[model samples]
Target chain A: MRIARFDDDRMGVVASDDTVVDITDLLEQYDPLDAADLLPDLITHFDELKSELESRSASGGGKSLDDVDLHSPLARPTKIICMIGNYREGTDRPQQIMDIFFKSPEGISGDGDTVILPPHEASIFHHEAEIALVIGKESKDLSRDDAMDAIFGYTVFNDVSARGLGREGINSFLGKSFDTFAGFGPWISTPDEIGELYDQHITVHVDGELRQDYNTSDIERPIDELLAYISSITTLNPGDVICCGTNHQGLGAMQDGDVVVTSVSGIGSFTLNVRDSDARQWQRGVDEEMAARVRAQGQEAPAQGNGG
Target chain B: MRLVLTADDRIGVQTDNGFVDTSSVFDDIRFRTAKDRMPRVLAVFHERRSQLEELAQSGTAEPMPALQAPVPRPPKLIAAFGNYREGMDGDRQKQDLFLESPESVIGPGGTVVLPAHEATIFHHEAELALIVGKRAKDLPADESALDVLAGYSCGIDVSGRGMGRIGPSRIGKSFDTFTPLGPAIVTTDEIADPQKLQVTLTVNGEPRQNYSTDDMEYSVVEILSYVTGFMTLVPGDVLICGTNHQGLGAMQDGDQISMSIEGIGDLQVSVSDPHNRDWQRGIDEEMAARVRNRAGSR
Candidate 1:
């Protein structure tokens, strides 16, 4: 099922009208550990809470998502493993090189969020639309089959990168990790239902025009192998996220006031804003064509520019 | 409340055995004192018992401290690089001089402050900051050297920029409170594979940065081998593995940087302003006098 953790840090199923029940009570009642605990424990017990959420959705009635703020799906987890060049066109290197790239957890972000571009230095900050898997079990030295079992769900992630932070040239952690550089969520779909994990058509748009386009099958190692490769070395704890990699076309950038839209077929899409220091430092420059696309997709209205 | 940091070109530390005085760790070494005296800390591992157990048992040596740093500020920080085809595909070229200064580095229990400018670009990267456990000369085999690991600590390298190509990163990464470290160091015995732990970071209670040790292009063994080849890695020297791909994001004032490694523990720090500039004569005199007075007190 499509599951989501939203509204100032609480978990609940997203309904039709965008109205939300305070599932915080339900998640807490069913939670084996405090929401503050590590995410792996929560994922393991997620099924234990499943029936309870269904009951709450049926019995409780209060509050609306419109009235609350959203947070990244996983409250707190041990790690956010990411793919560097899994996308076909993400790098300047050859195909085999796609097998190696790294992003730390600090790169994650979520919906209605801002990608704070650094002002102290001159660098290109870009958004990458990628699929991220949230592991549900502690997995190590696992086979590809077991690795797939460890996956709890999938979510959308915007991996922001600060290019050339240093010329070390090898490690991208410094250049790619700036606070709020990574963005994910909107919702997470569970494993059984995450049929879109692979073979999903993906696309990224900045302001309005499409930027990145590809499918998950294009990833160098694919999800199962990537999971196996990682499990061989380090253990992946539940609630841990792995951004498989962004498609090739997602590279380059999002200017201030620009809205980035990344979508994966079957899963849905995420809309985020490219914000700068000065509110007006950027202009969406969207007037007609963008509005039509938003309507065609039946997505929510874009966040209005705050005149920064 | 223990803390370790790479400051003034070396690892600065706080320990149970008094301050490590990182500069002193190298005093007995044969290298030039100017270069050898980088402030830092080093822990002698138990595996090296054969080499050090005699000195330790005979009362000829003191118990190692929990944390340590270089006595002098590090000239630069580097990690394994992967820009080229050979580097990206694990060619083991040792060309990955891939290191950058933390936007700020502070001892554990110390606060690393960041400037608040919605206009300034910002981000934080969680990484493994190695505190050299011993002094090893000549490039030893990866297994022979890493086998002597004293312990490990957690740290973050914060960066701030308004543009895309910020270089030297030293100024942007070295603000007070920008790099927060300490809490505790997991002695090597407590850790099995240094390259196989969970590395993560959170800001204002949000999980922003995360990744595991195995993700690095160059394994810790490879990195240490390459690093030691350039010079003797003295005890208490810190090597910060550049952050993984969580991506650079943003932070305002009052943000907390909690960097953690699964078995190694975490260093949680709050952000604030450095307000650091030139020191005043009167203040300096008082501080100098305080040191002078304290010199006699001990």
Candidate 2:
């Protein structure tokens, strides 16, 4: 029951045999960018559509998965909320209230896409791998007991961050919202198939070297609690993603020409290439100003010890 | 030419005579076919600026109806934090920026419902809002940041001091109806100098905030240039150039707040208690249930 949007906005079902059964007809009325608006319809009619996809696959007119480009499973999410400092085991800092931040929808890049590093010389880009929850229905003030029901599926999210900018007071949103900073999904795995959401293992690798490996069980606030808190603040619409925070124990930076892979077991994985921005010369002054401000603020400079 | 979106989602253009339905005046086949797909208010303005301008001069005038947020549900709403020199938490050094929930936007004449949790010590921040016209990303040195703007409008950045003092400003500034925008979007061509406009806010007929945009630490171009340096800003995205700290104070329920920019028209809003509002009662009940359930489980 893996649903995906691939090459040229065609909707398809990934069969167990690693082939894609075209189900574009079922979603003819909606455009590729309107995938979020079509999510509830897909969920409500999942059974009928699943059977039809199976029949279509049986007729032997499917394509191999390798033949097409895979896009993000959920397109045009109204919001992408990321939990900050939700992991407690790795840090000795005092436990504070759970902080949530936002990343622009434009930052989202699909599987096999490239994440362009900010041209600023001041930026020290880092990768945070965590599990992401895709909303199935419009939700508000959801209770812990009902929070899990509101989730349609799970995907892996790479919360790419500019550590230098982020540490400079109240720039968390900007630091994590650069173009192509958010990389999620090969495809979405439904909640039922994920068995126990909190028990799954999450991992991140940079150029084949493991950078972070941890179990979701290590999360301080469970998935239900996070959902309840976020829902209480604002409405969560279909296709919206909630990225659970990552453990900072093995957190590090990414360099140009590096490939970062983030994976959640029993779900899926995706890789994104890192490239330097073309406007590096235009960014020099701003970067220098930011660095000078960081020095003026008199805060401890961000540790540059974790070079990849 | 000024454009507005009414309560019914109809588009209108304000001219010297009155407001006219844009569809009635601009009946081109291409425009009719592409209107819904554009997804952003700025897209329509960008594609058919000349046609719209010609129509604005000759279109039949009609009386205005209740207005909605000009660009309701913009893809992104980025606000400048402490960009003004007179503000209390002013960091005269560099511009601090933060993202606000687009859902917080409410049209002119809408009520700013004080969240039940922190009902006391609310503040009103009147500011100028820039509507981006094109897809701008990593703007080159030669391009002027102002060139990317489609128009300008007025917005109130309501803050709940209780919640805002705790940590990041997102939660405090993001309550529903916290952002009151509109009246009409004055085209960038209409304004002579956006940097020197007068910004003022009055609460219940008493003048509280009055300052010129000249007091801002960073000019509009500088702010937009810095923002585009990080993320892409598409048409219909909004940037609220921060508010002046002068005359900053608390607002209370039943206060009628009005924010006006020199060129753009005024945006009037009423503040109400959310605890007693019909829609908020449901949310409050759900929140109470969660609190009780959590306590019981513990």
Candidate 3:
């Protein structure tokens, strides 16, 4: 099922490519006082609510997808964890231990939102396209076998990064946390809708020009392994996001007035407008040199801590 | 005005007589300070200050319940790295800061669960935490960062050492229950000069970190301005001033930790390590010595 939030906190099930069945009334039973609490509450109780949602979706007659402004399906997630260097880009390097970092939850913007490049002296800003996991239940110390059960659905995330920000020892906090930097939407595609999370083609386009074209098969760590490792470190709450890191191959700079579209095969596509007030520029087109340089660096050393 | 959250997650005000459960008082207006409404704390703190004060003055006093972090689950929990000018020569290096998981936050009387991660040591950093009051970004040259202040509180930054020697130090700092903040949020009016405040930390009744915010390399305003340059800080966002590494020491299993700032009241928590990891009982002389030597060399 493809669940979407649109037009001022209204809940709906996308009935077709262009129509959304109103399920906002179905959520009234949850007794949420505010719109911010709606999505998480719905997600937590989705099991019992699934049958009704399916019926309403089948009963069909609702608004056109174009008449309403779509919002991020998950509102107010407590954590937004993003994996770092979890892809190999078809390189022959050895596997490095996995690592993850965080982006401010407030940085999340929905589909069709604007990515405002903050006024900072950044070398360049690049959009990293990756599939993100929306956790279904509170989880901790999850084994790889149980990790897949913790996932509610998947959405495409743009791990927008600011280049030349000196992320060496700082966990890339400032570089990846500008408001509207973590854009994901369109809607969430549940696991049932997306069979086999692997081998799906992930792609990104800037101004109608393809920039990122990679397959999830290039992912260095399997989805379950990534989920299990992160859960061991901290608790994952319902609606929390875990963005699978992207392959750097075909990465490039994003500038003012650029329309960037990101898509994953079964999940559908979402568009974001990039606006840089400073009007600073970088060499356009794919930064193949940087991509090759990153690939040439080989794999990072294995993680040292006993946390793994 | 002092702000607090009860164990039931209701908003309250600490009064001289007792406590005022502000949750019910503000319920008609639909004010919620529950953990679920954490993102809205700053907005409430900013927009309802005067009304909260009035409610505190008139409400029937009741004993406060178990406490929670005043600004629990801030949208951003940014902490300074090596920011104090005392034990470490902070000026010798560039200004740096890192983000900690909001899930790491535990309120007063909470237990700091030391993860089973292998580390050379676990350190306790006591610092004065500033809670942002308004939405701010790229604080203009004409404005004072202090104008954006909401209040202050005591914060304990529980850090794991030796894990991120080759990369980002956040992993060591981002473990669950690594940040303990609270007791109460003392409004800005209660603190005349944040830089003049004293910060101290004790582990199992032993003195560890004791210093004045005066030793900070950058003033509170400077840190706010610098941070706002990177991204927008909305109400209730926490920016913890870095600690003076002097008097910093190791924390181990079953240790009682207490952190106090001059005006913000005391924040006490216990440390629990499942692996029962042990480090030297006194100050971490090795790290202090390293910084001391580095400072002398510079």
Listed in order, each prediction's TM-score against the native is 0.49, 0.84, 0.91
Model 3, B1-298: lDDT tens digits are 8888887777889998888977754454443225645446556666777877888999989877789888767767888766666655334455656667777788999998888777778888888898887888877533377778778899888888656423435667777788899988888888888889888898889898888998777778878877777777877788888887778888889999998998789999998888987788988766666555553221
- Residue A248 displacement (Å), model 1: 1.6
User: For each model in turn, which proportion of the native inter-chain contacts is also found?
Assistant: 0.01, 0.24, 0.20
Give stretches of model 1 more than 4 Å off: A16-19, A27-41, A55-67, A89-100, A120-123, A278-308, B1-298
Please give the lDDT score for candidate 1.
Answer: 0.53
DockQ of model 3 vs. true complex: 0.31
lDDT by residue (tens digit), candidate 1, A86-150: 54443333344222233434334666777766553434566677888888886766787777888
Q: Tell me the tens digit of each residue's lDDT in model 1 across B1-298.
A: 1223333333323443433333333334332223333222233233333433232233322343333232222323443432112113423233334333321345554565554322244456677766666665444546666754456677666655331111222334534355555554455666778778888777766676566777666666666765554334545455666655333345545666667788777677666644332211111233223322331111
lDDT of 1 at A87: 46
Clashes of 2: 1
Q: List the residue pairs that clash in candidate 3.
A: none
Q: Let me know the TM-score candidate 3 reaches against the reference structure.
A: 0.91
The residue pairs found clashing in candidate 2 are B87-B245
Q: Model 2 residue A301 lDDT?
A: 31
Give the runs in model 3 whose Cα sits over 4 Å from its true position. Answer: A16-18, A59-61, A66-68, A166-168, A298-308, B8-10, B18-20, B29-33, B37-42, B58-65, B87-92, B141-144, B164-166, B292-298
| lDDT of every predicted structure (CA atoms) | 0.53, 0.72, 0.79
In order, the interface RMSDs are 21.0, 12.2, 5.4
What TM-score does chain A of model 2 get?
Answer: 0.82
Off by over 4 Å in 2: A30-61, A90-95, A277-308, B24-41, B87-92, B140-143, B162-167, B276-298
Which predicted model would earn the best TM-score?
A: 3
RMSD of each: 21.4, 8.8, 3.2
Candidate with the larger TM-score of 1 and 3: 3
Q: A1-308, model 2: which lDDT tens digit per residue?
A: 56777887667777777787778788654333345545545654565676776676556447898897888876656688888757664444445466577788886788898988876654467788889988877788899999999987888899888765622434436778888888898877777667787788888888888877888887878899989988876678677889998876666667677788888997878888888755332211113443333233213333211000
